[model samples]
Target chain A: MNATASLDARGKSCPLPIVLTAKALRELNAGEVLLVRANDLAFVSDIEAWCKKTGHELLGIVSESGFLEARIRKAA
Target chain B: MGVTEEALLDDPSAEPQPSGVFETELRRLSQRVAELEARQHSLARSAAQEDKITLLVFSNSLDRLLAAFTMATGAAAMGTRVSLFFTFWGTAALRRENVQTKKSLFARLFGWMLPKGSRNLPLSQLNMGGMGPLMMRRLMKQKGVASLEEMLALSRELGVNISVCSMSMDLLGFQPQEMIEYPNLTYCGVATFLERAATGKMTLFV
Candidate 1:
């Protein structure tokens, strides 16, 4: 997925990834996509729940060797 | 005339005539339901608007302070307004390290007894002569978790409001200069905390 912005949260713990995701999403315009790469396994479900609560669009998630990449579109 | 019970019993299928009083009561009941629904809607809207959490930090222990800071930072990261009101022993965590401030003997003793800052705070349980905090810090580092100092700094950076209790300060003889430098920090009494907590979605005592 092509993202307007990217955030690398590798090695960060639970809340930091989500917290930093929210913070990074704030900097982007509505409808823009934010690609986040995180090694925390919890981010898989956390990003889904966060997007549901915040009305963002979770495009998809891809799990690679160790990190998980997620693309989220900011809510309008 | 309204249909009588005896008449209805005789002819079960017969329709009863509507009375003015009964119609008036029905209209009032529907209006009341509408009013209540409107109130419920507005309450939900206000709750969404007031996405805030207030925490009363009353302990200075390393574990409790860490918990408090973690919650504050997490809530702040989620775009919620967070307020931490530090009172009594909790204010010790805000002290700056190695600051020599002139004080009376009693005040000096009080200062000496308390932890210098977040880094020096003792574990609430199983302190084991300060070894518990050391082990906990090492464990946190090994897990790649942010330390208490980092959490505190992040909380400030995330715009978490830190309110120090002025009464606690007066009682402890702690001067403002001895406190760590934090943005959005304020010195206020309990009333200020109450006011902020009142408008918040949740208030926690830590």
Candidate 2:
């Protein structure tokens, strides 16, 4: 499938990483995936909560070295 | 034992014998118990402090672009639980649609004629029209200050949650689909944010 955009939220905090990810997704159409990077420890739960709160789907959350790379699908 | 009364009265400097040593030992034990109780009390207080979580709330205003970005990154840097909400024109400033922001007459005219989103927000703290903005921009440039876009980008990379007021969007006749695809945006009304902010956390109206 043709991929959309990618976002890196590494080292970002409560709302910033999410904000940047949202901005990237805003530039894409539905069903597009955004690659995100974040090192904020809170992102583990924060992204989970965002998905629940906004209905966005998290495709995967993987650790690269110590940082996290998250894949998100724009559902709504 | 009968001689002890007379002896005690006659020689007060006599070595303390084991006869009353048990009493002395009991007193010492009681003193130690008191000390332990005091330590326990202090330890309980310290533990309570350790259990408490810090929370900070930031309000993003239309003109407070840099401030909003700074607050997001700063609070996160401090490891405080942070939440920032964008409302009204604040949401307008974050138009993921990259729509030409409707600011000046020229911008509005161009916005209507072209596909550009709302005009990028002009910094309220600094505007080139006046000396304040001019000085601020000069200082920023000299100090290597990041642009508003750069700050927001860093803030998002740090995992800040970005919210757009749903009511504001409706009033402006804007749709989410019209904007670019960003994973960080949350659509909520003013009431929604307030309900969450009522938890004794920081609530800023910036």
Candidate 3:
């Protein structure tokens, strides 16, 4: 699937990655995927929970080196 | 004579009555199961509403404000609904610019001495007159902690309610427009705050 946008929130603290991803999701049309890169230790579960609460679909999360990459699709 | 099982099964409209200890035991277990399920559902509903946090912010010092906002952010992230009541000096923390005034001499003195906004707040201790807050802000950035502004932003995004004390605003000569137009901000008195505090599972004064 093609990504509609990508947000690089690496090195940001708790809530920033989720906050930025949320902001980005607002601008994207439904069914578009967003790629979020975050290095915060809490990013994994935070993103997962955020997606669940906001009704977004967490397509997948891949861990690379010391950071994490999450792909989330906006729910229609 | 006792009813025969063959007749009970063959008759579609037959009312089969249990006459033994096993049937009584089975009935009791099913009733117990229904009772337990109701209790479980109520317990879960209470748990979900029990994570509320009420923060009474009375200090305007930089360190204290930082602590208050950090706690607000953490509690909100943990799925707790948070309500912040700003009073006295705490009201100054929410101001975007210095509130213009033409009040009494004493009121003017207090207004001049107090920090005008979130960025101008003084450190509670070891301020070295002014450098302590600056140093701590830099250190917080280096440590990857969100700044007070960032936390406040997150708090708004997470629906943390921010309210200003009306009495304090009047005493301090602050108009509502002087403070940042935070989302859903309201001006209320102590009674309103008490109502919120009474319902919250966790209440804190900072």
Chain B TM per candidate, please? 0.80, 0.55, 0.73
Residue range A3-74, candidate 2, lDDT tens digits: 577776655554566656656777777788888888877777777766665677888888899889888888
lDDT of each: 0.88, 0.60, 0.83
lDDT of 2 at B110: 34
Winner on DockQ (1 vs 3): 1
Give one digit per residue, the lDDT tens place, for model 2 in B1-206.
Answer: 45765676577676565448557777899999999999999988755532112222232222366665666655543334556675655555554544444355653543343322223344455445445544655566555455566665655665666667777666555567655444566787767676666642456666
Comparing candidate 1 with candidate 2, which one achieves the higher lDDT?
1
Off by over 4 Å in 3: A28-32, A48-59, A74-76, B1-53, B70-82, B140-145, B150-160, B170-178, B197-204
Share of real contacts kept by model 2? 0.00
DockQ each: 0.55, 0.03, 0.30
Q: Model 1: clashing residue pairs? A: none
- Candidate 3 lDDT over A1-76, as tens digits, reads 8788999989987756776787788889999999999999999988988877678899999998889999999989
Score residue A41 of candidate 1 by CA lDDT: 68
Model 3 TM-score, all chains together: 0.68
lDDT of 3 by residue, B1-206 (tens): 23555665567766545345447777899999999999999989767644578999999998888788877876665557899999999998988765574677766776677777888888989898889989989998986778888888888887899999999998887778778878999999989988888767888899
Candidate topping lDDT: 1
Report the alpha-carbon TM-score of model 2 versus the true structure: 0.43
Q: Which is the better candidate, 1 or 3, if ranked by TM-score?
A: 1
